[model samples]
Target: MTGIKSIILAGGSGTRLWPLSREMYPKQFLKFGNTSLFQETVLRCLEVSDISEIFVVTNEVQKFFVIGQIKEMGHSIPPENVLIEPEGKNTLPAIFFGMTEIEKKFGNSVVGIFSSDHVLDLTAMETISAAESLASDFLVTFGIVPVFPHTGYGYIKTSEACGPGYRVSEFREKPDFETAEKYIKEGCLWNSGMFLFETGLFFEEVQKYAPSIFTSFENGGDINEIYANVEKVSIDYGIMEKSDRVAVVILEQKWSDLGNFAAIYDEFEKDSVGNVVYECDPLLLNSDGNLVYSKCGKIVSLIDVKDMVIVDTSDALLICPKSSSQKVKEIVTELKDRGDERAYMGQTVYRPWGSYTLLEVSPEHKIKNITVLPDHKLSLQLHYHRSEHWVIVKGMACVEVNGQQFFLRPGESTFIRAGERHRLSNPGKVPLEIIEVQLGELVDEADIVRFDDVYGRN
Candidate 1:
C-alpha cells in the first residue's frame, strides 16, 4: 500500500437515477445521510494511499463538487492532484490521464483505479492491497463474488489460479435474467470496475492494445486537442477484454454501484411492508416493496402500490415499476428530445460560491432564493436583458453596484438595473441568504457577462 496511488473517476452524468440526480448534480455528490458516494470513495481510497498520492479525475462541471466535498471532510488534497478533463471520453481515457499524471509525478508506481459512485465496504481494501503483488505481471481487476443472479452487472470468467487471484478467461456483458442465472452457475464474478495497475505494464499494454489512444496522449499538444482526438470508449472495451494478462481478484465485500432505483432500494433499510422511504414520511396503506423518495417533503399516500419506485423532486416526479427501473435512462432521453430544462438542470443549482433555488419563474420574471457561503462572493458581472432586485434575508451582504460597494443587513434591499456591473459577497460567518427577483423579457443564465470572476469563469 505504501507505493500505491489512487485515481477516482467522478465524471459520470448518472441519468439512470434521474429526478434526484441530474446532469449538474450527479449521484456521486448526493448525500444519503451525511457523506456522499464520492466522499465515501475518497475515504475508502485513503485507507490504501496518502491524501497527496490520491488523484481525482473529473470534468469541469463537477470539479468544484470534488473540491468542496473534500474540504468539508476536514482534509485538503493538493490542488494539482485534482485533474480536470476538458471533456469526458469515458473510462479508458480518464484512467489513462490519471496514469499519465502519476507517471509524471511518481514514475511507474502501482495505481488503483476506482469509481467515484460505487459503494464498497472497507474490508475490500485488503483484497485490493493483496492484488498489488500481482500488478507487476497482470492487469489486476477486482471482481466481486456474485451473491445473486444480477442482470445489472457485467461478468468476468476466471481460468486458473495465479498469485492470490485467477487469470481472467473472458469478460461478458450484462445479460438477460436466464443468462445471468447461468453465469452465476458457471461461477462468474461481477465485474467491479476497480483495478490495480503497475504503471509500466499498464503503459505497455495500452501502447500495444490501444495504439490510437496511446498515440493521441503521447503526441499531445493541448489537453483539449488530446481529448478531441481520443476515442470515446470504456476501459473494458479498449483494454481489459483484449489483454491476455488480465487477472481477477475476488472481492467478497458489500458493494453496489446503485445504478438504478432498484439497486438503491437494496442499500437502504426496509419497513414491515418491505418499503424503503427516504427524506419523507409516506402513508402506506397496502404498499409493499416500494421505494419512495421525496425531497419536497410532501405527504405521499400509497393505497395499494407494490414494487414501485416513486421519486419526487421540486420540478419532476418519476413513478415506475421496480422491475422496469432500469429504463429510467429512456425517460431522460425523451426529456432531452423534448428540450425540457428539467432533463439537465435541477431546481437547486450549486455553484462554487454557494447555491440558488428557483422559487418561481414566469415569462416576465424569475424568482430565486440564493445562499452565499461565508467568505465567498459572486462574480462581478452584468445582465444585459434583466434587472435584479435583491433583499437580504439572513446574515450580512456586501453588495457592489457598478464600482460602488456598500453593506446591507438582514431586511435591507438593493436594486441593480440592466447592464450594471454588480457582485454579492457574504462577509459574515453565517451563510448569506437573499431573495432575488429578476425582471426582463429574457432572464436566462446566458444573459450574464462577467467583468471579473474569482473562480475563473469567462
Candidate 2:
C-alpha cells in the first residue's frame, strides 16, 4: 500500500439521527459500543494502509473534532494531512481537493475514498484491494449486493463482467418502492459511494467533463473563492454517470448507510421482543419492535408501545414509528426555520481543550459547568456585554484577570468585569472543573473578543 492513500469524507450534518446528532456534533462522533463510527473508519483504514498515508477532509468547524477524535484513538496524523475545506461544496469538490493533495505527494497512485459514517464488514478490505488494482484503467466503485428492496440507496446496474468486477451500465437515482423492487429483481447492487481512483486519471476525467472544478484547483487561486464559483453537485451526477470506464466491485458482506432510524434499528442489536435499548434501562409491559435511547439516564417506562422509535436527550425527545423514521429530517428543517438552538447544538458542547455543559440559561443570566483538560487553557479574551464569575469546584486553576495572575484552589472563586481581559488555565495534574455564572445583557459565545488562542479560532 505504498502508493495508496485513504481519503475519508466526513462533512455530513446527519440530521436523520436527530436529538443525538446535531449540525455541530453529527452521528459519526456518537459512540455505539466503545468506539464511534468515525473512529471505526479510521481503525479500518489503518488495517489496510499506514497512518501517515491516510487523509481526512472535513469542514472548518469539524477540524477540531477530527483532531480530538484521532488523538483520542491514540493515533497522531500530520496537521497537513487533515485537510479542511473552507465550506462544503458537496462530494465532488471535497474529493477533488483531496485528490489534488494526493497527486502532489504520491503522483499517479491509487486512492481509496470512503464515507466516515458508514458501517462496513471487516472483511471488505479484500474487495477494496481488488478495486484498487483496477484503478489504472477504470474508476472503481464498490457495490453491495442487495438483500432486499432498499429505496434509500441508488442502484448500479452492471452491463458486462470484467476481471474481478463488472462494467457499470447505468447509475440509477433513488427509486420508489416499485422501482426499487424491480432493480433488486434485475440483479442491481446498491451504490456504496466508495471509490478507488488513479489520481492522474481521475483528474484527467474531471478536467474533461467538469472542467470548472479542475481549473479552479489547478489555477492555484484562493480556495474559498474557488468553492464559491464551483457548482454544488455530487460526484455521481458530475462524473460517474458520464464516465465510460466506470466499474463496480461487489461486496459480499453486511453493510448499511445508517441514514435513518429504521436503518439503525435494522443494524442494531435487538432484544427477544425486537427492541433496541441504549444507556438507560427500559421497563416495557408489551412493547415490541421499538428502538429506545435515553441519554439523560432517565428510566423510560412504556406500556403496550410497539414499532416506535424513542430518543430522549437532555433538551429534546423524538417519538416516531419505524416506518416514518425517514421523515425525521423534516423536524430538523422545522427547527431551523423556528430558530431553535437545539437545531445546531446539544446539551454538552465540546472544544479542543475540554467540554462545557449548559446548567441553566435565561435572558439575563446563564450558567455553565466547564471542564478543562490537564495542561489545557482557555483563550486570552474579553467580553463586550457580559461579566463572568468563576467558582473552582475541583482541581486547581490559574487565573489571569486584567494582566494580573493568581492561583485558586478548590472552593475558591474569582470574578472578571465586562471589558476586562481574562484567561483560565488548568495547572494541576487532574482535570479542572469550574462553575461559571455569566451576567449581563448579552451572555453568549458571540460576545467574546479573543486576543490570543492556542486552538487558532478567530
The numbered model that scores best in TM-score is 1
Q: Cα-based RMSD of the predictions, in order?
A: 0.9, 1.3
lDDT of 1 by residue, 1-458 (tens): 46789999999999999988999999999999899999999998998999999999998889899999999999999998999999989999999999999999998899999999999998888789878899999999999888889999999999999999999999999999999999999999999999999999999999999999999999978889999899888999999999999999999889999999999999999999899999997899988999999979789899989999999999998999999999999999999999998878899999999999999999889999999999999999999899999999999999999899999999999999998999999989999999999999899999999989988888
Worst 10 residues of 1 by lDDT: 122-131
Q: Which residue ranges in model 1 land beyond 4 Å of their true spot?
A: none
Error of 1 at 2 (Å): 2.2
Which regions of candidate 2 are displaced past 4 Å?
A: none
Q: Candidate 1's C-alpha lDDT?
A: 0.94
> Candidate 2 residues 43-138, lDDT tens each?
878866788878999988788889889988999988888988888889999999888888787777799998999999877987788676689989
Which 10 consecutive residues of model 2 have the lowest summed lDDT?
125-134
Whole-structure CA lDDT of model 2: 0.90
Q: How does each model score on lDDT?
A: 0.94, 0.90
